[model samples]
Target: MPRFMGFVRMEEGQGNPPQALFDAMDEYIGKEAAAGHFLDGGGLYGTEDAVNFVVKKGEVTRVDGPYAESKEVVGGWAIMQYDSLEEAIAGQQDFAELHRKYWPEVSMVATLRQIPDEPPTPAED
Candidate 1:
């Protein structure tokens, strides 16, 4: 089985989705979790208290959020496992569809990508 991550991106400060959406999501997650496909997932708070560390010219600088540069941020994510990429895609599509159906006015994107089984080699200097 291959593990994949679904990054849920949406506009900042849009407020929460509808209760119906949450209810639907709860049901969906429950079903998938029971099937052993959904490994873990959760929503994230706004970037109001976020912190970032940037390195430039071998110097480290700390920057605190809420960041002004981002119009959209990843508000949620999921770690899931599937037998094939196609199966993962379909599962992710179904997850996205729930948001589309329950929150028609809001725009959301579920970016799905597989998690590598082993660490990659570090870049050479």
Candidate 2:
């Protein structure tokens, strides 16, 4: 199975989706999980609340908000586990359709990748 990241973008000034919709999506996702299609997933707050960072000349610079962007910014995301890229894309397409109905301007960007087996450890012993 492969891992995928579903980055969700919301229009400016658009608040969070309705609880009922979310609950329905949760139930659907739960079914997928039972079928071994889900690994882990969650929502997130607006990008304005996110801390941005950059590196230059080996120095790190911290910004108060999300990094500057020309297009819609990522508002939230989910990590999905699927049998193949096609399956992951199909799932994302379903999510996008649902999102469009509830969040018309929202978009889902899907990135498929392999989940690493271990987290990176600190250098210090």
Candidate 3:
């Protein structure tokens, strides 16, 4: 089955709707799991807590903030296992609708990719 990464973006300083969003996400995940489409999902903190890294001249520079300066930053994300890109997209659309209801400025960016047979190794490991 193919896997999808759904990135949920929201405006900075917008009140964190973690509880409400998580509630809706829980419901969605339950339904998807019942349908055998859900794999795993979770929310993330603000950009201040997220790390940013850039590779330049074979050297990596680490920054203590989000890499992007758009009004919206990645607020959270979900990974869904599905049979096809269409199915993954359908799920993204559904989540987008839910977000629209509670967060008008929220935007969802989704990418569907086949899960690798072997997981990528961490640099330190």
Candidate 4:
């Protein structure tokens, strides 16, 4: 099976949804995970808590955010495995629809990208 990442983006200023919406999302996520479509996922704190770094010629620089000007930022992500790209896309589409239905007041988007499959290497004994 090929793996895919479902990247979740949210518009700035859109805080967390209600408890009911979180409950519903939790239910949906549990079902999908039990069925093996959802391998891993998580939501992130706002950009104010984020940090940016740059490294050049062995020198490192760090920048802390109040990264306020960006209109959208990644808020969450999901990893899934499926037989084909279409299947991966459809699975992500379902998740996106869940947000649309449960968090109608918030703006969220999910994009799917295929992860290259790699065979596991044997352990040295």
Candidate 5:
């Protein structure tokens, strides 16, 4: 089985989703989880709450919030098990439709990536 992560990204000033969107998302998550496709997922706070650290030449430097130059930040993520990348993409499309219904004013993009499988055991573990 292939595992995929749907990373939800939103613009810097998009703000938080409305209560209706939250309710809809909760219902959606339940349905997906019940179907056994969804493994784990959750929404995140605004990007202002995030921090960025850059280490160069053994020197660690940190910068405060508003990372990525305020272009876009991940607002949520979902881990799912699927058979193929096409299936993963379809699942994300469905989620986007739900978001469109609830948050018409806000724009978002969901990116999907496959999770690599762990290496096999040596001989006996």
Candidate 6:
């Protein structure tokens, strides 16, 4: 089985999703967890309370969030395992559909990437 990370992105300050979306997600997550496909995942708080430690050269700069100009942000994430990339994509597609059915007015994007099982080869100069 291969594992993948799902980054759920949406606009900042978009507020909460509808109650129906949560109810639908509860059932969906329950099934996925029971099947052992869902490893772990959770929603993240808004950027207001976020702290960023950026490194440039040898110096580190601390930047506080609450970014007023950020139009999109990662609102949540999920770790899941599936037999193949297709299966993982289908699973995520189903999740996106839930939002469409419950909260069609809002837009969302879920970026998926596989967790590499091997170390990368060093590049030649």
Q: Judged by TM-score, which candidate is best?
A: 1
Q: What's the lDDT for all of these models?
A: 0.94, 0.69, 0.72, 0.84, 0.85, 0.92
RMSD of each: 1.0, 4.6, 4.7, 5.2, 4.6, 1.6
lDDT of 5 at 111: 85
- lDDT tens digits, residues 1-125, model 2? 56777766654445667776687788878887898877677767666777767798999988775535625566666778887878888887887676667656544453445565577787996
What candidate 1 gets wrong by more than 4 Å, as runs, is: none
Return the lDDT, model 4, position 69: 80
For TM-score, candidate 5 versus 6, the one ahead is 6
Give the CA lDDT, 0 to 100, for residue 61 in model 2.
Answer: 89
| Cα displacement (Å) at residue 107, model 1 | 1.6
Local lDDT at 66 for model 6:
89
Reference-based TM-score, model 6: 0.92
- Model 4 TM-score on a 0 to 1 scale: 0.83
Clash pairs detected, candidate 3: none
Off by over 4 Å in 5: 119-125
Determine which window of 10 residues in candidate 5 has minimal summed lDDT.
66-75
In the range 1-125, model 1's lDDT, one tens digit per residue, is 99999989999888899999999999999999999999999999999998889999999999999999989988999999999999999999999999889998887789999999999999999
List the candidates' TM-scores in order. 0.95, 0.72, 0.73, 0.83, 0.83, 0.92
**Candidate rank order under TM-score:** 1, 6, 5, 4, 3, 2
Q: How accurate is candidate 2 locally (lDDT)?
A: 0.69
**TM-score (C-alpha, index-matched) for candidate 1:** 0.95
lDDT of 2 at 15: 64
Choose the strongest candidate by lDDT.
Answer: 1
C-alpha-based local distance difference test score of model 3:
0.72
On a 0 to 1 TM-score scale, where does candidate 2 land against the true structure? 0.72
